[model samples]
Target chain A: MKNLIKNFFAVEEVSAHCDGPCGVYDPADARIKAEAVLSMTKKILAMAAPDPSDAAAVVAYNNTMSRYIAIKEDQAHGTKTDILVLWTDFFKPQHLEATPDLHDKIWKATKLCSACKTTVSLESAEALMAAVEDIHNIFWAAKGRDVAYYTAS
Target chain B: MQKYPENAGFFEYVLLLLGRRKRIRVTGASMLPGLKDGDELFVDPYAYVATHPEEGDIVLAWHPREADLKIIKRVSMVLDNGCWLVGDNPAESTDSSQYGIFAFKRIVGKVTSRS
Candidate 1:
């Protein structure tokens, strides 16, 4: 059955492990998600703790906090996904040689992404941004692009 | 003694009948610039039976990871341990480096001719 299917597909070789070489790579994806995580973290921290005696104030506070947390978690995961795809599909051995710390940088950045998801600390979110910036610089350098780094602040 | 020129066709037919020669359609881009996808290849199953495969020879072998998967790759080097197969298009191919050495027993044939 396998041989029959192999013959049916008859594709001599897979050019790439993923979708071949589509030449579509953008660090901007990671950047956008990382930015969102940072923004949500800031928003959550800035939001006031609702008055314990006021029922309506407490409900509003709970709703805002939940919404911000949800966005932060979603965007943190998105950043991880974006970075993983680039690491696996776009970046190659040559890129590694060019940027010796590429693996370590990505590892730290992904861990920070997870940290942001787990906690609502501004420090964790800022660290995530810094790690993403490192990745962004390396990505553009690999591509020979001269994109400048800018922050939401 | 008679010259075998007149029996050339007969000899080839016998080889085919005996499963010494085979025809398989090439399917991948690993050997691009030399062989294209969908190209038909005439394989000499006996090419490496008596002698070792030489470097640059395109061969059909079972994939190292998947025994049932037949892969066509070029012999990059004849190693003391095993033959090292590499694809013509290195950027696009996942060769011995990714899958490990291909055993001689796994090699089915040497691609003698292609169209």
Candidate 2:
């Protein structure tokens, strides 16, 4: 029994499992990408010129689309990582206790981020922001004392 | 719990964990029915080095510009300039048609299992 107790106490705590509370993350990082996706969707819809028989338009359009895709991909992943960090590192048991639906909201947000590819529409991007806002609200509420200082500065 | 030697630094520990590719559960319905939204997938980081994927093979590729993100899609066409990729869903996916061909280096690993 003594050995068991000793072994349990000796266990090393795991670090780096979650992104800690540092005001380093920006919601704009995701917003910028979402905006780009929306713009690209509009471009695709508004393209009036016929598909160029010559290789030039094909090349240009392809290149632009490639860049857009890359940006969207980056944003989607960034949001995922950010949300994960918030859930694992930032949110505490008290926050969950206060906001009973926090878990569901986070899960739905993560799922929406992944499911964005389902449509080329901007709805996914909008949904992501909405979810992030909910989290931000809870996060700010959790730090009620700090909020005043943060805003004043 | 026995503690191993503490020589490994933070980055070293991270590399060790990331060094061995992990099989993660696929949680999106984009691939759908075939590779169900929540199916398990084995991602071998080194698989791309051994064999470049062919059409119809599902793959996980690094999202360009962000090293942490992974995007999974199927190869629709392999052109000399680049590979054309598209999601299984026609109306829903914004794949090669929307984004054009993904460069070869972006590819990470091909999905080995759905179970």
Candidate 3:
């Protein structure tokens, strides 16, 4: 019978849904970028001021310090983007029920990203890393997956 | 009477589809210009068994997050672990840009032809 054949095949219906590909969230990207921010901040803070009397030394130091600042800012911005994507695209309303402070947490994390970019503060860099780690844990918890967070740095 | 031609791809689809025929009713605008909503399509489940999915190939795959939901998208890039897919109708489709990457194993089959 057609019914029997149809039941045997049982071709279920599929759909093309929206709201981004599912379960693509990973906090590791933010962590890696934040680590770079932290490393660059450290290097910048440790660099000795070039001799004020020697123009060449000053220029070289300025060149190196500028490069570090550029990298630090770039990485911080990248970290912010990654975190914001997770906040906006990954987290849902139900997650708020579990972590009511989710909004505040993401807001502060993004703020820290900006702070890291504006200043070469080791304190801010470390804070960003901590914040990112916290987000990592929260993200994994929401997915009910125990993904261990690690830093390449 | 002799028939000149029909949809050219249907012949290929028939040959490759074999016993893995699956009928899918498209309902999204993701694949616009070429495929429209309510179009009937047949899938070749064995299309990628021996070979891998290549760029420009349209495929039906499991939604990475929602396992029960199967989605159709075109492969844009082939990565080490998976493929990057996007909807043909970029304005309407939420794809790799929305998610990130889809594991290769999630692919169900190639969208062979219109039925």
lDDT of each: 0.74, 0.57, 0.80
By TM-score, the better pick of 1 and 2 is 1
Against the true structure, what is each candidate's TM-score? 0.53, 0.42, 0.56
**Whole-structure CA lDDT of model 2:** 0.57
Q: What's the C-alpha lDDT at position A91 in model 1?
A: 83
On residues A1-153, what C-alpha lDDT tens digit does candidate 1 reach at each position?
Answer: 323322333223322221235347788888888999989999998998977999999999999899999999999999999998888867877789899888898888899989999998889888888888888899899889999988665
Q: What is candidate 2's lDDT per residue for B1-115, written digit by digit as tens?
A: 2111122234432332555334445544345335545554444567678656777777776554445756667888777765787656433344566567788887767655422
Name the lDDT value of residue B26 in candidate 3.
80
Chain A TM-score of model 3 comes to: 0.88
Q: Give the top-scoring candidate (DockQ).
A: 3
Q: How does model 1 score on DockQ? A: 0.07
DockQ of each: 0.07, 0.02, 0.18
Write down the DockQ of candidate 3. 0.18
Question: With candidate 2 superimposed using the best TM-score fit, by how many Å does residue B50's alpha carbon deviate from the native?
Answer: 59
Model 1 bad stretches (over 4 Å): A1-22, A151-153, B1-115
